[model samples]
Target: MSQSKPSFSDKKQITYYSRLTQLGIGEEILITLPELSGLMFTSTRHCRTLLGQMHEYGLIKWEPKVGRNQRSTLTLLYTLAELKAELAQNMITAGDYEKALSLIDNDKALFEKLLVHTSGTQMREGQLHIQLTYDRPFSSLLPHQPQRNSERFLLRQIYSCLTRCNRDGAVSDALAHHWIYDETNLVWKFFLRPGLSFHDGSEINAEVIVSLFKELQTRPPYIKELAHIQSISASGALCIQFELRRPDPGLAGLFADVRYSIQPISQLLSTTKAIGCGVFQIQEHSDEKLKLITNNQYHGYRAFTDSVTIWQVSRSKDYNPGEIEIRTGGLVSNQSSSCSSYLSAGKTNSGLSEQVHNRIEDGCLLGILNHRSHFTDSQLKKIRYLLFSNESLKNKLDQSLDYNIEGVLAYNLLPNWVKLSAITDNDTQLPKKISVALFNHKGLEGCAKAISSILADNGIECDINCYSFDEFYRRAFASTLSEDLLLTSVNFDDNRPTSVYCWLLSDPVLHQSLPQQQRRWLYQELEALSSITTPQNYLTQLEPIATTLVASHLLLPMFHHKQTLHFEGLLQGVKMSPWGWPELRDVWFEQ
Candidate 1:
């Protein structure tokens, strides 16, 4: 895989050779040396070597022209696809799957045939590793750094918090066995479980727990989320205590958030990977894939599954809306101990309840109009109305963004009790041209195209920019400030309203969207809700933030996504978590 070869011996030899065949095969055609080199994706010297290799294989005949910009005559002898297909088939039959699969050369037909049996799941060294086909690469595994729900799920497995939230939104034991609130002193003491160790075999004592919370202060989101903690001190070797400036009704639930996962950062492969005390340990981490091994040193019940490997899979040329479906068709047997699947929402083909788990997530795909742009309030209102005021536009967008698969038209930002149905005031100004930015993702380019097509009919020009995942999220400020609109998805634990408080304080993009006075006023409003003990009272008071944002036309909710997981029938205890992800530790294969 590391060594280079003659361009003719390249796996894409099929594509290059077939292109040459198009130039009146068996008859010399006039073509420049540079043109041939460009077609073959090789240097001029390699072009000559490739021609020689092809001539030896009876694929093409070449004649050289000895002057600059002079034409070179090349005659094709045979078709390349058929020839390479035959060789690759022979390689497949001879057990050289690696070499056979290398002939992708962007050929969809050959790729499907060769990949049919190699994708999905397999057993190696008696470990059960389910290879889930994912659309994006794995993000950092460190606590408070999750960029997606998938990464959040993986991080949840790889780390533990002092407390955990049950499915019902109640606090439960995690690293800490139990906790008691001292009413007199406004303190919380959490009793830790004994015999706990990190993935690296370091003891997880009270001091380690104290260090974890101290570490959280340096990370954003949590830095604001944990602001109520006035002090974190080790009570003893097996206990930890927290002193708060004021009483927090939801402190335990806040601590249970996965963003607050306790982990000791460690170095590996010249990059840092988290060393956590959870049911699973990250054994391999990369952009291509992430593999987790069961943590044998965990305090409580160990993970029943041996391993979970998520493969970062991009959509091939032949892709369907119903499925990203990276697994090849036919001969990829279900007989393996592990499973591999390109998951999508809805009932599976088997019609069995156990075959799939599905639920609507609390997240939303949002189109935020950039307030930093030159657009007036009336213009932003006009754009929002044009995009979402009518039913057909939202429906058309639903299909473009795969929202029809298992999503609902978002009536409001929060999925809970808030229902917004007010008609937008149509009296407005309009922009002649706007620049739109989107995080380059599945169906998003299509989304931009659809929006462009709609705006073109309205005599408005659009400049579209798509940023990679890293570029969009890691740039430290709202990249959309320079554009007219930004399209992205946000997942938050809306089961509790603390997320609303945290997002307002921590989300740079959202924070930058409001005017200076408006932002200051919103911050003061959010600050006033901190002491509210009742969840209903808290949410009721917080309702104005959503109404204010919508009234100002800062952001529009497009759709709410539905998350689903498909697993083999043998996998037991398959269920969806509140945040729309499955806990891998809870799943086990049948013996």
Candidate 2:
């Protein structure tokens, strides 16, 4: 009989090959059915099924041990790199680029080629489909539940808020075409466009708006933000009225918030998908990719790009984003043998260029020190010194930031925020060692390892804890912070006072976990600060509070950083949103 070939598509075959490849290729001296089964993630019976297949491929030599506790000798015929490359090639040929990239073992040439094939904007079946890679699988795109900036960006495309804040920080009409506030009577009325509908094609009228807010009456920030409203009701088919106990000038900004994005109540309760009324609708979402198509029925200008496909891929994605040159004035056709077609209305992209553009972002790799239970004041000071005093460590931290956040060293983003003050007494009896907390995200484990190594070198004991976004949000709200330091990146992406206010209000560990008296005082201070209108006035009033935060060493802002993103010249009418993502709504992909 002819020897059978192993199928890469078969999970069992792939697992068997992968495990055999790890058993010291032709050098393995001992093994057993149970031990082998555990390594392959299959039962002993399943392991037996793979024995014949493994032998048939001449990839593994297996000798069975009949008795329990008896050792079996198994030896592989191939190295891991050899097996992975073959499997990765197989996946690549099959057009499973996400899976292919995951299996690649630092094959730079292969990585680039796979990325080139998987990425870039292409015209397909009357739609301009732009493809890009993300580091992980799709998570919640629900209006209020986004855990990261990427998710937030996707949410903006998939959902519509009552109002929207523009690049100039001015509030503009969105779902609500026109709104008026009766400041004297403490009442507000919003008029929705007639014939508006949700993504599901259901009528999205004043009644739907009123019903959604009623459901949100119990959720966070909303409960506090909308508390002044005595009643919210529908005036007619197209009008919503809010009767308030107090005047709320910030209602426009509040409605612009992601928390208030309108979605069907039924889909809001589903875990598998998010539905809304925006310029784009989720056509397909899976572990490999999230596909969004233009909603032509959108009340606003229809999205120029018909589709955007975000491929869930590994960071091994390496390709020159400058591949497509964006030139204006005259049209340029492809000189190569390959035929060129329009990806969008007038955009014509030529191949890769040697030139690249740089974008300096205003963000930071912030280290928020939990000033409560974990560490004493003295210990916190020492920790700060060990973290910030060394220029070498800052370089390493900057590198870590680049890997994790795609950021560069921020020398002076915030003059008052990034404190470099040294500890007065290095020899004074140091306080107890503390734990460091990290978010469970890509490239963050490396940050934890780097931090732990630096502290360990200085004779300091450091424990590391990782939490998912859910755990981080849920625990912090209950005023339970177990770690000494909560290190995360902050973009202040929204770039509005509301953004700052939202940060202060939502970060329970930063505010709510404070001493009862201190928390109350801060709340009152924020309440007063919220009413200030002018920038100078806001800063003048906020300075004292900021000073207290830094001087008291509540949370140490260690490193402020900037991220560099590449945009092709062909991408036209694209501007970075306040949230640090490129606004794709009206982009032409002009080449």
Candidate 3:
């Protein structure tokens, strides 16, 4: 074979082209203004002169030399493709790299443009600016659907849920007091608080509650813990009874979950009424924006602002409040870092200032495994191994992480939440701890903090690694992923109290993915654990782990951060709940 002549190593080679399709740059040729129209600006002849001047300055290069004698007027042709590349190279090589980088990285124009166009959905002439970063098309914008609630944004403004958190950052006692278990957790009785009502002017009563439970039994979505119920009887005006086959101790905490609480049955019937008993009432709503008015009849603390608006934003640019009018989303607890600074100086470089006026709603994040996958067996085993072998994981899991080692929870929610027979493990069988992974950076920080605090209080010791939400999702959903879990927030409408709990404690009455027997077993385990009291005793059991892990400073607790809105000017005179709402009755806006 003729040895490939040494590839020309030193010669500089160049390729010239009329257009750079990849970069969207094209060479410029001057012809009377006619050609310029198609090549540069079709509406204006001004572009021709602009290109001419650019070539003169050597900012762009001309193709053929200018001639002296020409019929029409001869001018030099320039290559925008070559000019841009040269400019890009100069930016990389120059010491002032930031200037060049800025050309690519700057988003100021984009954001300002979006700000002008967020309201664009209805306008044809003017740009409506709505800013967003990511899109989850599969998500259900409505609460009763199978998808997660819409991702946080200003749109959270118009809606209000039944449960509101307290100043101590705990779900309000009123919400927690709903479920109370008698001697045997199996005979569970819940009392609907009096004076509670939905926005439809309907008082929440036993009948509405019975209808809600029936709905859960018929159309369970996220409700998992209520599966163990053999039957639920609404005892007239006040009490509801849950009869189970066997005694369970963990039932109380399961009821305490805000996601399992009741909503107004009538309001859920129509999207129009905005009939929630919570702090705010819907004034106006569209896919793009929502306006909420404070409920003067709200039974809880008065809202702090006169009105709250949720405006849909565009995804084209990063946000700076100056580019758009500031709006609030779900409020974060004082567990956030900026809360202290805000309380002291009234300002800080954090999202807290914006979210301060928002409110807290009940939610739970859970992990759902893809049991049908080929690697399901290995993943399940791996999760079991990790949860049992890793002391730290198990310790954090007791309170925030709820699972049944027996595997009673359904693989998915399909048809509804209904009672399934209890599963029994052999006497020799040991409970398996579940191995789970969560985002170290996002809401997981709060989960980790809660677990760590419990560990510290109980004198257990452990170490934890920090991770981003993206990484967590990747690992949790990976194919080779054996033994991985994801944290999902369970947000329930008040009208759907027992739905989530039923799902947690029953086999798939709907999806029927996992064997009914296996699901029943899982439900039974969950029900037993759900009956167990966790708030006080949970930390004590972790003492052994705390002594070893925390003593070494391995596991650390970090507080959760949430966003809200605040007003400074004469706007201070506006009266509403922590999250803004136009509380029209007893409250009014001064400005």
Candidate 4:
């Protein structure tokens, strides 16, 4: 009788062969199925399936012990070429094969070819190695420019904000040791931590603080943040006082924005010479990569690793699983790739480890109706009811790819955190025809199709218009959006509802369209919320305002999406900020 050949999934074959090539001849390795599962981001059952196929193929002898501690062992029985042939047949990438071979031969050249750069500490101490991919090349390290999350991640490491928001969204001291608010005088007194110094060894004082604010007042984003500042003065040696135009309780939150990273006045003119009192100092920066070294002169906790190197790859597939990887949404796939470990944020489950899966509640998706468009108020209200009231439509839309329904479907502008009275359902007449504008991005086309189908079922004609992201932004800012409805997203920098309120009011286009009375009401509500000192009470004050806004039918809240991070087993003490960036100061490699 002829012997039959065993079959395996592409993931199983690649993982098995890769592991085999890493071992020396006659070297035995013991790996518990659970441990292997964690490493591969696979289920224990799937790991067993892979082992079964390996044994059937005569690739390894799987010995199972009857004890909990002694789980199973895999022994190599095939030559390197034989394993290579299997991997090639399974269609593993050339880069992956080279990575595996490099591990076997202990060759640094092949590994270097795959990575952008490897630091001396990483090479010598087997320290943490991280790989990141971005959609666009990094523009600037300057704080004034609008930055993506990747840029902010690097900035947080190399720069220091006056106040920092912890994982729980509470404000903590960074450059400033502590601060006080004088309600009577409408002023804030910030006391700098003594002995604070920049990377160049100059002591930080009230003059530096005042100078930074003066520079900030000249830039955008900060222009709005500093508009209420009546005057800023350096008091004593370490004290800097700011007199506000009004009594604002959320002033600390404003200082905590990542864009407010304090820099020396002397280095402000030189963009290349970016310097701050952060935990890490910039060793080198370019469009392709950023290299950082630990700051021994840091006043607070020091980074556990000596250096960090971030490379901007063009695509996620370029990421090597052998090193730590950071990626945004939509890059990971359903099938596991042996080339690298995976972490997914939001609603994606592609190769995500349960331990590393995180859900951030700060991101809110909105469906804003352009009051300037053709739709009338009644028509808009009816459309909102049709979309939000139908449970079936919500379920179908929730199942769409990359759509995370973890957050409550927003009926109003306020996030689910704020309690508000329920919106009473009323029967209304639907418009015969409706036009919706959606940005042409990944997964949104499917969403547009779903919405069209839903409206069609209700006997209404739906027109879905898709435009590129640039064109969409152009139309939005120009107030020339022809569609009655627009889909958009916004993220709050701080946990306070005041930030959300400010964002709603700051949009020049949106603000211009609001009626005079409504605009006055918005400013009045903002003042009320800003005066509340306690966060809980501030949230309480948001309910009435949110209820009034939702009744206006101007904005519809859809859902909130969370960001995720995946780390290799070698990384320890990893804590991510609320803004979805890893706090690297304490992250260390596990032995």
Candidate 5:
């Protein structure tokens, strides 16, 4: 086997030749010079040189300017049988040779009329094409920097977390081959896989792991997560140990988050561009598109597609067939026929042959009252009653938004898994007028308008105000909200119920504007709840506190927003995280 192996320098050339041979004899392949150049990762001049060499060898004939937009044609001179024999002699393993032959045999018809093009290149037998939406144009490859859903999706391809969380909420190893927790010592030790190399060809080991965590600690969210960590030390090349201030059962889940992806310390300091050990490597990235090629040296399950291209689309209607379109803004009432709609939670439209929708229970939307508003206590009580009890407004919002009101309705802060008794409502008379403020997120505009309309129908005169997210945050921090009520949403990325409540109650900007006695009691209640370790005890202790908070009308739980992913065609082995992002490693195109 070793004696028949091709030389390292010739391997890529052989692979390229093999791909061309799969086209079979007499096949007129229509491919633009730019497309071929991108596929080969070379300049147009270099691609021309490679094509000329192939033409000289009698493997293919290049016909210049034969198709639309001056695209050239390349005719293959070798048959599949001849290519199989050539690959058999060059491939290091019998399995590789057989796989190559099988692909050619399976896609024989496609090869006969293959139209090589950009955008849909991944739809071809060995490619994967995807479309994602970003809020704005950016080039930061760092996993933590990109705040949009599209950028985060692209980052997942380039980065690998220490651990992975499955759809069933199970924690599994990714970079860390195995891990163990020392309860008595409050220590967590992880054993990494051997011989793992980053995309930049740097070895992954314990020292690198420790350094990444140390660097991560300097960031905002990671700093909060790692606050309990006393120290992170490397025992050897393959083992890393973390000492914590206290026992945390959910520590492994924290590592499973993509934000904590491990990267080389050198890359962290040297550049903002990413260098990862995941299944894909960034070939090129720009404001409009992000292109990735498979990382052959990846230690885990390799992606089936040779390359993936993510296009930044302005609207859902821009999606095309054979592409995975991620629509962060909920599906509009008017969906175009260009592509089938798939919810982010993995639900498909009825009768749509090619669609994938994965529903993720990500977070809840809440109605927050500005406690510092000038309204008297009685007036506040009436406002809360009108907002929560008005079913007409909720229904209109639900119909316009196309969301299940009952399914997403949140009566408590805890997730559905933790069942707490519902709060008893004390009805109050409607006030003459009320004002509500909403952040100017495009998706929330319809819902906010619906609320205003509903309030108008009642005796109350409704004043609806919109503010930019930054302006809203600034006013919120300064406790100078102009509206009586604020409409906003919060994602509980951390599955732990305690963490969710801690964030809600402990936010200084949010709760500081409350009356002194109410603020004191809220903090006191949170402090007591924080001490309970067991989930059962915690839930039992939290029931009355949640009830009290709801009754106080400071925060009104509205509904949980279900995250969905819509795709144009069938995708196999697709799964989603609790936070609504797709697990793309195992996903493959199904034709």
Candidate 6:
């Protein structure tokens, strides 16, 4: 019988595509007949036959862009048909036609190219941008998040411990794993999780625990919560004992303080790194942007996505424009009307909040104020009004003048109080100092009421000098140091209840027992030792110091902060921390 033109089976033709069979040229960037002949063993005559067969089957078409005009030849441009023919022809010259076919069949790179060509190259690049604002100039890793909830909301994967509070706002560990109460209810025993490690690769043991408390003592005075701690001794790697001289219902709440709880003391001490056992690790950080990568080593569940970035920006309805630029050692949060105007107009998406942008502008001008110079009536009234409304104005006061307004009813100092519970029940009145203190300058709601309630219940005079953040800090520093006063409220961002720092006035016995001298000293120390450079450790160190100083008051047992979040994907066993974020281990990606 005569051979039927050496035809290949339909199965073989389909297999070329289905099994990722490589087509076209290899070894030669620019495929020519010579290169193809070297690959295909069949003779040029057989190559011509294969090309005719492929052309008739419409396997490929000619490309004018890559083809050279061959006026003498019928084929103006070589198609895949010619390419395959050339491959076979080259194999024939080598005396191994079957081997050449086998080589194409096993070539992965060729297969990928075929797939890419067939799919038409569907690869693409994606990018994301975020906006953020900070009260202070965006310092390096100095943790100064407004609230634990805000921090947690922004950074989704940090470990946290939450406490359940009683109706009286007392931190109750009754349902906790191990609960014990002593005479004054001043001592607490906590069982630590086993196998916890710091980001610096240090084992979390009693020594680290002791060092943590010690570090807190040396930190800024604002964090005086841990001050009441006479000692913190870990019984084992997993157990610890905290001894206090007096009762404090707020102890459990202190754990919610973001400044107090992030781990890796060494990382906090290092200017280059601020380490935490969160779901994400810092991939890159600048004053205007923060980028994080998933931390595979996290004991908590994984984050919903692989990476996130935050951009530092300011937004405002006003004409102020802000400046964001990289400075030596860190990025500078500079705000000016010119920059704010651009950002607000939506012409420049710098990603800053209006409050933050304005604060920078206000701070820049306030920083240059000279109280010593003679002031015009308008200037003096403005200064007096600002100072009278917010104690922070004291920072701008002339150093030569002693016209200090102490214990004066600067104003009614009344704040509209709101209960944190589902329903307002057994509500306590609030004072002005705490009310003004809690005002969220970034248009944060409920701060005034929250602080007012806490102060009202504490039986202390209600008072505060409500000012912008930078102005508040500058003036508060002056007042806190020279005025011999300590401002106390539910620890900000610690997820502690306002009642923990408030509500002590009702308990006369507890208030009388507290040592005023110690409290004064603690306050002075915080104001004296405060520094913007090390704001993270400074904030972290405040908890223990504050606790130690106020322990005798037996105030709010544990501060309580509540967080509620919304998610679209499967998130399993999510636990909310004081920082207002979810624990990674507690959260699982269902999809």
lDDT of 4: 0.59
Q: After superposition, how far is residue 335 of candidate 2 from its true place, in Å?
A: 27
Give the best candidate by lDDT. Answer: 1
Global fold similarity of model 1 (TM-score): 0.71
The true-versus-predicted C-alpha distance at residue 561 of model 2, in Å, is: 3.6
What TM-score does candidate 4 reach? 0.65
Q: Model 5 segments beyond 4 Å from truth? A: 1-121, 131-155, 167-169, 215-224, 264-271, 316-360, 370-381, 396-408, 413-440, 454-484, 492-552, 562-571, 576-582, 589-591
On a 0 to 100 scale, what is the lDDT of residue 4 in model 2? 28
Lowest lDDT block of 10, candidate 1: 331-340
Expressed as tens digits, the lDDT of each residue in 1-591 for candidate 2 is 111265434555766677666566678668778887888888889888787676666657777778996888887776766666656654543446667767775665666545433354555455666665555676867875635656776788898988886423467888899989787897889999888898878989988888888777766645666666889899998999999875566667667766678887665567767778999999988886788989988999998888776665543422111112122112332311111111222222445332223344334455667756546567656665666445645566446533333344332224333333555456655544668776775344555666777877777688988888678767777767667777665544452445555565455556644556666777777666654342223334554665566555555554443323344555567655544445667666533
Candidate 4 structure quality by residue, lDDT tens digits, 132-170: 433334556765544433465667778887786642336
- For each of the candidates, the C-alpha root-mean-square deviation to the true structure, in angstroms, is 11.8, 13.3, 17.6, 12.3, 13.1, 19.3
- Sequence-dependent TM-score of model 6: 0.40
lDDT (C-alpha, whole model) for all candidates: 0.63, 0.61, 0.37, 0.59, 0.58, 0.36
Candidate 3 segments whose C-alpha is farther than 4 A from its true place: 1-143, 146-172, 175-180, 184-186, 248-252, 256-258, 266-274, 318-371, 376-524, 535-591
Q: Which predicted model would earn the best TM-score?
A: 1
- Model 4 error, position 364 (Å): 1.6
How well is each residue in 59-101 modelled by candidate 3, as lDDT tens digits?
4443433443221233333343343333432332222324433
**Candidate 2 C-alpha error for residue 410, in Å:** 6.1
**How close is every model to the real structure, measured as TM-score?**
0.71, 0.71, 0.41, 0.65, 0.60, 0.40
Better of 1 and 2 by lDDT: 1
